[model samples]
Target chain A: MSRVGIRELAAELGMSISTVSRAMNARSDVSAATRERVTAAAERLGYRPNQSGRTLRRGATGTVALVIQTNTARTEMGETFYFNLCDGLQQTLATRSLDLVVLPVGASADRDRFLVNAVDRHLADAYIVSNTDRTDRRIEYLTQRAVPFVTLGRGGAADHAWLDLDFEGVAAHSVARLAGLGHERIALASDDRDINSTWEYACGYRRALAEHELPADGGWEIRVPDTPEGGTVLADRLLDMSPRPTAVVLAQETLAIGLYRRLREAGVEPGRDLAVVGFRKNPVCDYLVPSLTSFEVSLVDYGRRLGEIVIGLLTASPDDEPVHEVWEMTVVPGESDAHPPCEKAAG
Target chain B: MSRVGIRELAAELGMSISTVSRAMNARSDVSAATRERVTAAAERLGYRPNQSGRTLRRGATGTVALVIQTNTARTEMGETFYFNLCDGLQQTLATRSLDLVVLPVGASADRDRFLVNAVDRHLADAYIVSNTDRTDRRIEYLTQRAVPFVTLGRGGAADHAWLDLDFEGVAAHSVARLAGLGHERIALASDDRDINSTWEYACGYRRALAEHELPADGGWEIRVPDTPEGGTVLADRLLDMSPRPTAVVLAQETLAIGLYRRLREAGVEPGRDLAVVGFRKNPVCDYLVPSLTSFEVSLVDYGRRLGEIVIGLLTASPDDEPVHEVWEMTVVPGESDAHPPCEKAAG
Candidate 1:
C-alpha cells in the first residue's frame, strides 16, 4: 500500500487542504473540535505531512547541526567528551521538539566550505560548531551572515555567542597546587591544534608561573597530538630535558594514561617520580592505579546550557543580547597530583 | 547583503528556473554549453539552491540517516566503535555527494516510534539503524514500507539488508582456545541488553561448550552492563561462585579493564589466576597491565561497506537482491589470555 499523505487525508475528510493543514498543525485559527477530528482522522488514515513541505512553509528545518571534526586518532576519552556533550544537547532540544543532527567534517575536507554550504542549503535551523580555532573563519562567516548559531568554544569574534571551558582556571589551579607543593619547575602539555582552549591553557600556565615567581622556560611548553602515542612522546621529551620538570599538567586526559604507562616501563612512577594532572575524570582514568587528578565538569549540564542559549537565540527578537559564557570545571584531586615533587626526575 | 538564491541566478542569466536547475544538476537534457554558463554564473553570483526545494522536487533528501542508540552507560569502547564506523560511512557517502546525519535515539525514547517518525517525515534517502534487537518492529516497519534501509546488525526481518559482527565466531574461538588449554570450567560474559549480538554470542558459547563435551552450567552465563563498573560486579560474582571458572571470555573490552582491576585487588592476577579474553582491542585496553587478547576489526572498512550497501539499496532497482553479510573480526593475541587453567581452587 502507498503511504498516506496529507492530500489523501484531506480528500478523504471532504475538506480543503488549508483547513486540514491548519487543523493538523494545531493553529490558533483552527477550532478545537476540528483539530481533534482532523488529528484522529489523520492518525486513522496513517497520514504524515512531508517534512520538506513543512520545512519550506515554516522557513525552518527544526533541526540543529552540530559540526564535529573527524580524525582517525580520536581517543575513547575524546569520544566520551562528545557523547556526553551530545547527550545533554539532545535532551535539551527534545523539550522544544527539535532534533539534533551531528555532522562530522572529515580531516581531509574543507571545514569552512562545509559549514558555508550547510548554511547556504539551509540544512538546519541552527548550528553548533565544535573544535573552534582562535582565529576561526567559520565564526566570522556565521557572525557576518547573522545566522542563529552557537559555538562550543570561544573564537576571535567576541560579539557572537559562544561557551568556552574554563581551561585557564584548570591550569591556574593545577599550577597553584603543584607550586604550593614546592615544585619550582612545571611543564604544560596540550594538543598541537591552535585552538582557543589550548591558547587559553598555555596563557594560564604562563600567568601561574609568573605569580609563583618561577621562570618560564620555553622548553617546558609541549604541543603534541592528543593520542596515547603522543603521551609516550611527551614522556620522552620530558626525560630528554637537561633538568626534567617535577610536575606536568596535561590539557587532555588520554595523554596522562599513555604517560603513566610509559613512565612506569621506564621505572618512573607517576605520582612519586613526576606529578601529573589530567584535564577530565574519564572512565578509563578510573583504571589508573593512583587515580588521575583531573578537572571535572558536568558535560550534560553544559550541553543543556548551550541548548538553552541556542534556542533562546533562535526564538528571541533581533535586539536581544548574545550570550558569551565560560563553563567552570572543578578539580577532582587524586593520587596522581598528591605528591609534592620528584626527588630524582629521570630514571 | 542578502544571500544569493537560484531564483536570483536564473534572473541574472536569462534562463528559466527549470533550465537553470537542470543545468546545475548536470541533467543530460541541458546542453553542455548551457550547463557551463549556468555553473559559471552560479559561482559568480554565490547562488545556492535551497535544500528543501530540491528535496521536494527530487523526492529525496540527498542525505542518509544513521540511527545510533543513546544510553548514559555508553562506554569508551562504544564510542570508538561508533566513531570509526561513522568515519567510514561518511567517507563512502561523500563519494555520492550525499551527507551522513547521525540521529541518536535517547535511552528513554521509543526507538521504534523514532524510526517510524523519521521515515514518515522523509528525513533521508536511506537509513542505517544500529543496535538492532532480536525481534525489532522497526525492521518490520521498514521492510513493509519498502523503504531504502540497512541495519548495522541483524534483526528478526531476514529479507532486509543487514551487516552483523561475527560474535558467534568470537565466542566459539575463545571457548575453543580455553578448552584446548586444559580448562574444563569456562564462563561467558556479555552485556545485559537483549540485542542480536548478545543472543548470538550466547548461542555460540553454548554450541562451543557442547562440542567440548563440557557441562553447560546456567550459573556460568553472566549478563551485566557494558561499563567498567559492570566488570567490577562481574569480578565479585566470579569470586562468589562455588567453583569459580578457571577461564572467562568477555564480550566487551571495557568489562575486562574493570574485571582486571577488581581481580588484582583480590590478589587474583588476570592472566595467571584466570584466563581472560576480551572482545575488542580498545585504546584503554592497551593500558591493561597484561595486554588483552581480543578481536580487531577495521571499523572504517566495515562502515564503508555499510555505506556502499545502503547506497546500492537506495539507487538499485527494486528487484535487486538484498545483502546480508557477516563481518569477520581477527583475533589479536595478548598476554591476558595466554595462561592455562589456574592450579589453585581459591586464592
Candidate 2:
C-alpha cells in the first residue's frame, strides 16, 4: 500500500491542513479531542511525517551535530576517547528521539571556514563543538548568530553551555600522589597546543607544587604534541636533565607506551628507576609491562552529561541559566607508578 | 541587507520562479544566455539557494553519513581505525563540497530500529555502512529500498558497492611467514563474530595449512572477542594445548598487548618461546617490548577510496557498474614474530 500524506490525512479527518499539521505536531492551540482524532487517523492511515516538510515548518531538524576535529595526530589516540563520548551522547540523545551526527572537520586551512558555512547552512539544529583552543573563534561566531550550542571544552568570553574535564584537578592529584611517594623532583608532559585544557593542566601542576612546598621549575614542564613521538621526546629530555626527574606525569595516556619504550632504551626502567603517571586510562594501559598508572573518567557518563545539558538548553526558556559541568577525574593506580625511586635524584 | 531568496531573485530577473531555479541549477532546458544572466544577477545580489528548497527540487541532500556501530568492545581499538578512515573520507568529500556525517549506532536493542528509521527519514543522501556481518539485514534492506550505499565489509546476496580488507590474503601471508620460520603448527585468533571477514580469515588459514602439507586442526583456530581480554583468553588456551602451536596469528592488533602480558606472566617470551603476528599495525604495537609484527593498511587511503566509490555511485547512471575495492595489507615485520620455537614441546 502507498504511504499516506498529510493532505490525505486532513481530507480523511475533514480538518484544515494547517489544523491537522498543528495537531500532529502537538501544538497547544489544537483542541485535545481534535489532536487525539488526528493522531489516531494518522496512525491508522500509516502516515509518516515528511522530515523536510516538518523542518521547513518548525525550523528544527531534530538532530545534533558533534563537530570534532580530525588530523593525523589526533586520529591515532584520540579516537577511542571521542568514540566512547559519542556513543554515550548517542545513548542519551536516542531517548529524546534526537539523532547524533558526528561531523569530522579535517586539519586544514579552511577548517574554520567550513564550520562557519555549516552553521550558516543550518546543517544541524544544535552543535557540540569539541577540540576548542584557548581563543576559539567558533564560540564567538555561534554566539553572535544566536545558534544553540554546547562546547566540550571551555573557550573565551562566550556565555554558552559547556562541559569540561577537570584537568587541573587531575594534575593536582597526580602531583600529590607522586609527592607522597617521596618524590620531590617531578616533570609534567602536557599538550603544547594553546588548547584550554593544556593551560588548565599547567596551572594545576604549578598550584600543586606550591601547595606541597616544592619548587615549580619551568624547565621541568615539557610542552609536547599529544602523540607517541612526543612522549619519546619528553623521555629523552628527562634523561638529559642535570640530575633527572625521579618521576614524570603525562597528560596524555597514549604517550605512556612511547615513554616506556624511550625509558627502556635509555637504560631506565619505569616504576623502578623512574615512576610515570598518565592522565587518562586507555585499553593499552592495562597491557603495559608495568601497567600504566593513569586517571580514569567514564566517557559514557561524560557524553550523557553533555546530552542532558544540551537538551536542557535547547528546551529551556530564553532567560534560563546556561549549563556548566566539570567532570572530576580519578586516578587508577598501576605498577607504572608503584613507589618512589630507591635513589633520590635532583634535577 | 536581508537575504535575497528565490522569489525576490525571480522578480528582479523578470522570470518564472521555476525557470530561474532551473537556470541557477544548470538544467539544460535553460538557454545559455539566460543561465549566464541569472547567475550574474544571483552573484550581484548575493543570492544563495536555500538547501531545503534545493533538496525538495533535486531529491538529494549534499551530505553522506557513515553509520558506524559503537560499543565497549569496538571502542577499545576500533576507534583509531575508523577515525582515520573518516578523516580520509572527509578530506576527499571536502574537495567536492559534500559534507560527511558520522552516525554512530549504539549496541543496544534499538540499533537496527534506529538505522531503519534513519533510512526511512532520508537522514542522509547516502550511507556508508560499516561493521557488516555475514548476513547483514541492513544490506538487503538498503538494496530493496534502492538506497545508495557502500558497505565497508561484504554482506550476503546484495549487488552493491563494497570495500573490504583482504583478510584472506593477510591470513595466508601470516601462515606462510611463520611456516617459513619452521613453525609446523600455528593458530589463528580472529573475531568471534559471524562477520564475513572472519569466514574469509578461516578459509585463508586452512588453505595455507593444506598447501604446506600440515594438519588443519580445528582446535588450533581460536575465535575470540576483538579485545585485549580476548587475547589473554587465547593465550591461556595456548598454555593448555597438548602440543602448543609455536606461532599464532592475531586478527586484531590490540590483542597483542594482553597476549604479551599473559605470555610473560606464564614465562613464555613471545619472540623466543612463541611467535605472534598481528593483523593490523596500531600505535601500541610499536611500543610492545617485543614489538608486534602486523599488517598495515593506510586508513586514510582506505577512506579516500570509499569516498571515491560512494561519490561515483551517487553520480553514476542507473546502468553503471557498481564499484568494489579490496585493500591488500602489507606486513610490517617487528620483533614479536622474529623466529619460531627451537623445540616443539607438549604442554
Candidate 3:
C-alpha cells in the first residue's frame, strides 16, 4: 500500500502541514484539542519522529522566503543564486530538515495583495525581504500584522528585523577610495531600479559627499536603470558634460559594464581617463578586459540567516520581542578603480 | 489579542494539521475516535476555519518540490525556466493555495530523503524532478517507492509520471539544419559537469549523425566542463585537429559563450567563422553580440503539468496508472548554422 503522506492526511484533516507537525511534535503551546487529535493519529499511524520530521515540526520551518521584484528586474542572484541559496539552506536546514521557498512579486503587482496572498497564508515561518524600499507596503503590512520578517537591506524605518549592508557606510568607503586616487571631479552612475533602492544609495552618496567636502552638484548624480545598456547610455550622457568627471561609482554591476563599453567607445580608458567603482559584483567581473572593482554580499549566508530569523519569529510567542539581526558587507578591489592622475578637489 | 493560528493549535495537538483540519472539516474517512477528540477541543477554543487552515488541509499542500542534484555536478534549469515553471505552477495551484519548494539535493541527500524527510516530515505533497537524466537516482527512487513524482526535460527508462522534451527527434532536426547549411564535418561540444546530461546530448548527436549517414569521428566529440573557460580551452584544441569540424553543436549555453570568446580572440566570428549551434537558449541570448540560436523548452508548462500530475496522484486512487507526459521542444534560428550546398543521402 502506498504510504499515506502529509498531503493526503492534510486533505482529510483540513489543516496545514506546519500545523500538523507542530501539534504532533507536542510543541507544548499547541491547543489541548489539537494535541489530543494529533497524539491520537501518531498513535494510530505509528508516526514516530525522524530527523527532518522533528525539525519540520519545530515552530521553525527551516524555511525562509526571499521577496524580490519581478524576474526581469533581477540582475544579481540569477538562476544560480536561487539554486545555490536553496542548496545552502537545505544543507544547514536538512541537518535539522528545513526548506527554502522563493516568492517573486510582479512589477505591477499590488503589494498588499501579494504579501497577504503570497505570505499571510503562513507557509514559511519567517521571511527574508530583498530589494526593499523605504515606503514598502508589504513591510508596513507585515509590521501591522506583526509577522516575523527580515529585510535584506535597511527598510524605510529601522524598527524591523533586517540583515542589511550599510549603504551610507559603503558610500563613504567608495568616496574615500576615490579621494585617495586624486580624482576630484567625479560622476555618479546610479541605477534607479526602484525609488527605495535609489533613495538609500543616494542618501549614502550625499552623506559621503558632505563628509568629503565635495560639491553635491545636480549633474554629479546621473540616475538610470541598472543594466549594461543603461550604463552605456548614462556614460555617454555623463561624458557629454564639458569637463567631465574623472571618476565614477557605478551603483549596479551591469551598469558598470555598460560604463566600460561607453568609455571604450569614447576612447576613454577606464584606468587612465575614468577610474570607476561598482556595487554588487556579478560573474565576468575578472573576465572583463579591465576587470571590475565592486562590493560583495554573501547571498548564501543571507538565506541561512533569513531561515533562522523567520523560523524564530514563527515559533516565538506573539508577545515576544521582535528579533532583529545585522549583516556585514565588504569591498573588493579590481583594475577599474586604479588611480588616474591626481587633481584638485571641486569644493 | 492576536488570534491563535491553526499551526499553533496543531503544534500543541501532537498531530499534523491535516488530521486536525480533517477532523474539523469532518471528512467521513477519519475515524469517529479522531473526530470527536479534535472537534471537542476545537469547540472549546472557539477555533473557526481559518482560510489557510481551510485551504492547506482541504487539498494538496499546493506545494511541489523541484528536485535537482546539489553535488559536484549540476544539471539545473535557467532563470526563465525556473520562474516560468513557478509562474505556471502558481497559476494552477494558487487559487488552491499551493507553493513551490526549491529542493537542491546535497551530496549525501537522495530522492528517498525527499520523500521521508521532505514529504513525510515537512509539508509537501509531491515533487518535480528537474534535470532528470538516464538512470537518475531520484527518479528510480521515486518510482520504486510509489511516491508522487514528475520529470522535466530528461527521463529514465522506468515507466512512471514524467514530462520530457523530445530530445531524440530534436537531434534529427539539428542534423537537418546542419545538412541544409552545407556542412559535412560536424563536431559536438559536450559538458563534462554531469555524465548523465552529457550522455543524453551525446546520444542525441549520435542519433542525428546516424540519420544523416554521417560518421561520428574521433574529433567529432569534445568533452569539457560546463563553463565558458572550458569552451575557450576546448576551442584551440578543436581547431588543431587534422580534419577540423566545419560545424559544431554545443550542448550547453555557457560553453557556447566560451566558444564565442575564444573564436573572437582567434579573430573569428561565430556565424561567419564556424557554423555553431547549441541547446538551451540562455538568459543573455539576445544581448549576445550576435544572438544565439538554440532550443526553448517549455519549462513553465512542464512544471505546471508536473504539478497537476502530482495533485492527481495525491487525490486519485492508489491503483491508478502513472500519468506520462512528453513535452515538445522548439528550435530557434540565429546566425549560427547554414545548410550544405548539396543534398546528402538520408540514413
Return the top candidate by DockQ.
2
User: How many clashing pairs per prediction, in order?
Assistant: 0, 0, 37
Report the C-alpha lDDT of model 1 over A54-95, residue by residue, as the tens digit: 222123677888898867465334367776777777877776
Superposed by TM-score, candidate 1 places the C-alpha of residue A30 at a distance from the truth, in angstroms, of 44
TM-score of each: 0.81, 0.81, 0.73
Ranking the candidates on TM-score from highest down gives 1, 2, 3
Q: Write the per-residue lDDT of candidate 1 for residues B135-203, one digit (tens) a residue.
A: 889988987897888988887657888878888988998889889888888998889987888888888
Q: Residue B162 error for model 3, in Å?
A: 2.0
Return the candidate ranking by DockQ, descending.
2, 1, 3
Mind giving the per-residue lDDT tens digits that candidate 3 earns over B1-347? 43443445566677655456556656565689888888777767655543323323333355666665544322232244556566556554554556655665655566556645665554566777776656667677666666667776556574776555555555557766986776777788877645445666677888888878887886678888765578887788666765667678877666776787887887666666577777766654444556677876654454545555555555545454565544446788877774342222111
Off by over 4 Å in 2: A1-58, A341-347, B1-59
Worst 10 residues of 2 chain B by lDDT: B50-59
Query: How far off is model 3, as Cα RMSD?
Result: 17.3
lDDT of 3 by residue, A75-128 (tens): 322343455455545555554445656665543446468678756556676666
